[model samples]
Target: MAGVYDFTAQSLAGEDVPLTRFEGQVLLIVNTASACGFTPQYKGLEQLHRDFAARGFAVLGFPCNQFGGQEPGDARQIAEFCETKYDVTFPMFAKVDVNGSQMHPLFNYLKNEKSGLLGSSIKWNFTKFLVDRSGRVVGRYAPTATPDGMRKDIEALL
Candidate 1:
């Protein structure tokens, strides 16, 4: 895929969702893991979404189990966990690998567009990629970077 709009991923409910749906919105695409150390970041992500969604901003979460099997749950379980624990209102996709040959196309494009400190491959869960309204990759944040820490950049995009 050349841009964010050229990709599609399965939603948490197993529906194929096209990235084109968010074409004109500033997006924070994150690889999430329910059992990871950064799992609590979901709350912050939800907060960001709630705070900026009215301004054409969104946070898209993609669950991944590749890191220590941190997100070892089915779609329904993950959905319930996110809703009950974090009260997440943003869209979340199904568990997917953010690295390796099996990585989702959207992630593959994101990694290639904005490589991390060392390389394009994701180091762990919770790594975030910021995309502009035009489907352009703007920034890549490490897994350790808290969701709240991205406010400044997200605000700039908005």
Candidate 2:
């Protein structure tokens, strides 16, 4: 019965963020990368955040470099790239490994809650997990899924 609120992650600023703080809000959790082809998606995600934020919705980005080392940057570098390039304003966490033995606990819980086409392991960067207002995993989206396309799903949950 464990939900996403049971986990905590370090923010890009190095502060501990308990997922519980976001309870009762529909969440779009994504693993992001700065140097990947999908890096541009950050703009769309930020747009989603701004559009639905007043309605209890947020996009949480977790930087991951496990795929082709696409996010090979320190916390500061990643933060700068997101802000300068895509103008990302959503809450972003520190770099993490999303598909390995040392994967962060939040991701471990997420992949288990909603496995992808292949399996529980994350296939690539930009993989997204949708959590409902009750803090339960509701849907999983592949790395290729775009933020704009998920508005309906998010609206339904809200």
Off by over 4 Å in 2: none
- Each prediction's total of clashing residue pairs, residues at least 3 apart in sequence or on different chains, is 0, 0
lDDT string for model 2 (38-112, tens) is 888898899999999999999999999999989889999999998899888899999988877899999999999
Per-prediction TM-score: 0.98, 0.98
* Alpha-carbon local distance difference test for all models: 0.93, 0.93
- For model 1, what is the C-alpha lDDT against the true structure? 0.93
- Please write out the lDDT profile of model 1 over residues 35-144, one tens digit for every residue: 98899999999999999999999999999999999999999999999999999999999989988879888888998899999999999999999999999999999988
Model 1: how far residue 32 lies from native, Å: 0.3
TM-score of 1: 0.98
Which pairs of residues have clashing backbones in candidate 1?
none
